[model samples]
Target: MISGEQRVDPELTTVIESVVGGTPCANSGEFHYSLAERRWEWSDDLARMFGYEPGTVRPTTELLLSHQHPDDRATGEAVIHRVEDGEPFCGRHRIIDTADRVREVIVIGDYESDDQGTVVGTTGFYIDLTDALEEERNDALDNVLPETIAARAPIEQAKGILALIYGLNSEQAFAVLKWRSQHTNTKLRALAARLVEEARQFDPNSPGARTRFDHVLLTVHELVDPAADAS
Candidate 1:
């Protein structure tokens, strides 16, 4: 059992390691903050995600908050403050790394406790969804499509569109598309093609992008011909 002042707990570390290992994407890393010690620990992957060399720079609350995107700083700060107060942390936000790259990430964690069950700190992981989505897009582009281009291109593009708009992982995005296809009684390819075409009209960086996409996603299937085999 870990004592209140213990810097590291082997058993807790093992559990964290197992979770990171089992994650579908390699774009995730663990973190721990010791409230009593006011110390922070970060995995190498997390450091890289923040555009820092592992062990080269110290991790502090200010440094962490500084990396948050301008629009998301308030949300990030709230999560940090809550964690500092021994509360669980779970938030999806954006960060601007050292190289000025924007990354969307999900941070999930719970309060860490000592042997006597006193809250000692917070432990959690960050999943870099932007990187994962980009990788998925690249992989889709690299795939060898069978026969007609109509068979795969629209579906892949549509999946990417949904993933970004809904903050969904690749599998979840695909499942949603399949569900929509079934419910609308439209061919998957046709539905995807219509979605992709509609999505093309919106500027993703705009404030209303999500709202526009939400409307498009809900009604794009209506535009697709149910009898069409290819979009």
Candidate 2:
């Protein structure tokens, strides 16, 4: 039912379809209304964007806005309002994409007019910013994992050295280093850095690297953190 409170214009529907990504079927053509009486239709892409599909989704503007990142919501809402009021629409905002990935998108919307030139409906364009968002996510992960969690110091250096020589992932190399430290009775981080330095100085294919690593492991364990051997 087109509720008594709102009247949606028709051109907006076409705008959504044009911008929607068919493969992912995300918010391509849906517009929402704040007043309860408004009834509008949505394209499948739009349905998907708001976390719904062809059969089960309820179309609402609130649904669309709710997925917006807090930082982007205000600007997005204001732009939509200007379009609804017959003003030109333009903005960029961040939203949580269907994959729960925060993406930034460019928005451009406008309304249609009848022969009388009265505002009949509105349409909008959305361009995905998933790439930008993905970059942000990667940066955030690097900052958090390398700086906050994990064994803070030489664990990473050892991992890099192992990757440089043995062609192992950081996680795998770390497991090997930790296991070797436990066997030799040494502190994990210090033992890792010592292994890294030895690997840097000697080639693993030469066999002498192993002896050097062991020798340094013993010396560092004895000289640096003495309790490391006991632990």
Candidate 3:
């Protein structure tokens, strides 16, 4: 037993490790905040994810937020507050790794609470999408059949729109669109049409568009394949 007022399932830790180990372009870490002791616990992999040698740095909310990119720091703080407030948290953010590399990551965590429903801690995984993003940035679009060019025009248009709106490369944009299509039970061309139509209705710079864009990215995590994530 953990032998604390707040107990963690040792098996949950094991499952996290196993899933992360098998997952591509991803790593797992554990965080446990001792509310009473005001202390923090971190897994070695979590340390590495933040560019620390295992067992070297003491983990804290402040230290974690420090690794966030300047633009993402406020969002990181909000995530912490959500955890402290015992809300399930999910977000996309950027972190500066130990070597000063900027890594884009998706974080998903749920709060831990005592029987009395007081917040005890938060645990979750940080999945690195930097590799996929890089690949998207570097790879050229594949050759298309001349006969199929017209059929693919709307798709290409949608890809262009997504690329412009989300700062993704053409291939990455297409991948995201395809994922959304399959997950939503919509046909590819239909989804492509919907995306283009939706984009046309909003000024890209408008706050509503930005908000919807953020929500789209958040929901797209389900569409990301583990293998593609690492690539």
Q: What is every candidate's alpha-carbon RMSD to the true fold? A: 11.4, 23.7, 9.1
- Could you say which candidate leads in TM-score? 1
Each model's TM-score, in the order given?
Answer: 0.54, 0.42, 0.53
Over 71-161, each residue of candidate 1 has an lDDT whose tens digit, in order, gives 9898788777877887654567898889999998766566778789898987766767785666654544444222114555777777776
What candidate 1 gets wrong by more than 4 Å, as runs, is: 1-26, 134-166, 170-231
Better of 1 and 2 by lDDT: 1
What is the C-alpha lDDT profile of model 2 across 55-96, one tens digit per residue? 585655676667788886787787656655655444557778
Please, what is the whole-model Cα lDDT of each candidate in the order they appear?
0.69, 0.52, 0.60
Best by lDDT: 1
How far residue 172's Cα lies from its native spot in candidate 3, in Å, is: 16
Write down the worst ten-residue block by lDDT for model 3.
139-148
- How does residue 76 of candidate 1 score in lDDT? 83
The TM-score between candidate 3 and the true structure equals: 0.53
Segments in model 3 whose C-alpha atoms lie over 4 Å from true places: 1-6, 9-26, 134-231
Each model's number of backbone clashes?
0, 9, 1
The TM-score of predicted model 2 comes to 0.42
